[model samples]
Target: MSERKPQVLLIGFGGVGTIVSYTLEHLGRAEVTVVSRPETYDSIKSGYRIESCSYGIIDNYIATNVVKSTKEGYEKYGPFDYIIITTKNIPEISPVVDFLEDCYHESSTIVLIENGIGIEIPIYRKYPKAIILSGVSLIGTTLYEDTVKHIARDIIKFGAFINYNLDKQMQYDRCKHFLSLYSNDNNFAEYEENVKLTRWRKLVYNTCINTTCALTDLDFGRMDLFGGMESVVRPAMKEVVAVAKSEGVEIEDHVIDEMIRGEDGVYYPPSMLIDVRNGNYIENTVIISNVVKYAKRNGVPIPTLTVLDNLLKLVQLRTGEAKGRFELPEKRPLPEENYQIQFKY
Candidate 1:
């Protein structure tokens, strides 16, 4: 008899979530159930039209099952073999540990396909015995309504997150099994011996390009139009490398140039920029502030990152104010001369 397929529960069915679910179902290796927010549940439940450069256009793509919340997912599909979270790593708004309360089990392996460094710490602390796999995806995909556009790369590097509570060999074995199910010809996957280093490498881009674009409200191509590559992008990336070095992660200077060249002419709206446009809180803490804290602990100076972090905090404040998530005293009205300055332009 054929072995039973692994049962998987995936949370946050956005661009990354959609790609992961589609790939798992497309390969016919796993039984996938997704937990999406109530707002987008109906739309996603109907179907998705995926325009993928790697896998070609796929019409009416749907998962094995779709549910609204983690509670519903757990009640319907309990004892899941793998619980994958591809949600935005906004701990203040939605903590990662909250999602696992209902679904997580002793046998369940938690897979984190989210961004930012130090993302797996909280989960590891909470579920010490659970085997956690960190997935670093370099794919550039965006979801518009019911359509998902996989524009650029499709690569994911997976490694077992360091958990002293669990046996190292067992964690690696689980990671390898998941890799076998996820990787295919077009959707490339590789094993990473040191996932923390991989995360820091990706942060070299996220902390620099992603934050810069959100602050300037520019796409990849447009950022280059204003000489941001040499002025802002590269400098911030160098700071990231410095901080990583202090933590004993060696990232060569050439990686910076290679990353810049990779998106040389592409017009891509990074996830952070998209959040800004939608009046959503930017991932300031995980993506930027965490690195800043690291730099401080090791006495590694990161002036560029410091400036970026401060600016992003202001951006986050603006988003919070716009969304009414923050309550502040009414602003004093501007003087008549302040209004008149607009006409001078």
Candidate 2:
């Protein structure tokens, strides 16, 4: 008899999701069942043509199974060994915990491959018994229509989210086993003993550079053109480092410079900017507000992050209200326009 491959259920079908699904199946180590929306279900079910810089061209790829909703996936492929979530971490519209309620089992090992800081707290709180592996992925993959373009680096650091309720050794073993599944020459995967520190390090880039680029409507190269690196970017990163230190995670001072230098000449658009462009709500809570929370707890003054947080809240409010994600407020008529002076250029 042939060896039984591990059964996996992956949620989300965006750029990151596509790459993960392809990688999992490429080695034939796991049989993946994907959960995607009904709108793009057919297109994804047909196949994905991936153009990865690391893995080269992989034509006409599809998962072992594709389902529309998490409930459906659970009913069809219930009690999966591993459940990986690579969706946008937007809690207002949909919480990651809600998805788990539908498919979670006692033995399932959950893996989070999303962005933002402190994202694992809620999950760990809810599923205290289950082993949760936190993943910090450093890849630049974009899904446009049908094709997935893997643009930049492909590296992921995995570590177990500390759960006091579970055995530490068991958590470590599960995390290591899960990490082993993604072992391939095309991508880099490693175990991080202090993954939270890894997360804080990434936040130095996400909280500062990603948020700044989104708010200013510019890419990395353009942000550099405006001297943002010296003025706002570096200072904001320093603030992030301070916040991380407050949380007991000591991020190196040189990481700020390294992060800035990483995007020196690249014109890449950060995820927050892409969300703004797509009219989707930015990840304000996890990316910024959570850090602000930490800073306030430790009495660390983060004036730059506070200002950025307020601005991002306004942006999120506008986007959320437009999308009807929030309760509609009482509608009122606008005040009469005052006399306006016309100016000729």
Candidate 3:
């Protein structure tokens, strides 16, 4: 009998998603499909045009199937072996539960290839029997006209949720099966044991530098030139370290210091900053405000993160949900954010 290829479905086909799709399909390891917004659905159906110096450019790669919604996707091509989420960690607009209603099966693993802490809580609550996993993508990628420029090393730290008390061997088997789908030379994917600590480590950089870049409308390069890391980034990084330490994840002083400061005159804008420049809604709640809440519950104060969170909240009030069909509050007390970016959250 011929070996049956593992079937995989990937949701949130953004820059990161595109990178994974091509890598998986090119490997011929899994049957890949993408569930994306309707507007880009047709174009993605046409095929993803990909370009990366590290992994030669390919035009009109029709390797993966593309569909519009999770309902349509599950109806047509699921009970997939794996469903990976590559979108930003924003649960307010579309709760993770919405995607699982008609698609999830206990045997199938759900992989969240995004950032932020506390993301697993909701998924675990809703699908207690399902296998849940997460990844911290260490790549610098930006989308342009169906093309993704992968400028940084494409390394990903993936781990299954052991907090659910699933058999360790079972989880490892599932993780290995999912990890085998990618074969890109540039994409170095690995299994991680300390999932919570890993997420917090990344958060040290994100909650500090990413938040500052978004609030100031500057990229990493610009932020470096203006002494923003010293003036703004350090205090926030230290505050986040405090929160992480409260949660038993000891973030050393040098760890936060090494993360937030980058080489001067580098032009990489973190994802949140990119969202703001494009006049789109940033992942304000997940990366910033939510972390602040986590701090409060643990009795750790994050005054700087709080300030950054409030500032981005104001910025989004003006930037139209530029992504596509993402809606904003209609009747609100706050003025259009274009007035003046105030440090009040």
lDDT of each: 0.87, 0.87, 0.77
- Residue range with the least summed lDDT across 10 consecutive positions in model 3: 336-345
Clashing pairs for predicted structure model 3, backbone only:
310-345
Residue range 1-345, candidate 3, lDDT tens digits: 979777788887777887777777776778787887878877788776777756777777764577787778788988888888888776765666567777787767998887788887888888777787778888767677677776666789888876455777788777776776763556788878777788889988888888899888898888877899888888888888888888888877888666765644467888888777777667777777778988889988777888888887767666534444445455553665544323232
Q: Give the TM-score of candidate 1.
A: 0.91
Model 2, position 237: C-alpha lDDT score? 90
The TM-score-based order of candidates, best leading, equals 2, 1, 3
* Global Cα lDDT for candidate 2: 0.87
Give the backbone clash total of model 2: 0
Clashes within 3 Å, all models in order: 0, 0, 1
**Native-to-model Cα distance after best TM-score fit, residue 163 in candidate 3, in Å:** 3.8
lDDT of 1 by residue, 211-307 (tens): 9999999987788778888899899999999999998999988999988875456688788998998888778888999999999999988889999
Pairwise TM-score winner, candidates 1 and 3: 1
Off by over 4 Å in 3: 320-345
Listing every candidate in turn, what is its Cα RMSD in Å to the true structure after a full C-alpha superposition?
5.6, 5.7, 4.7
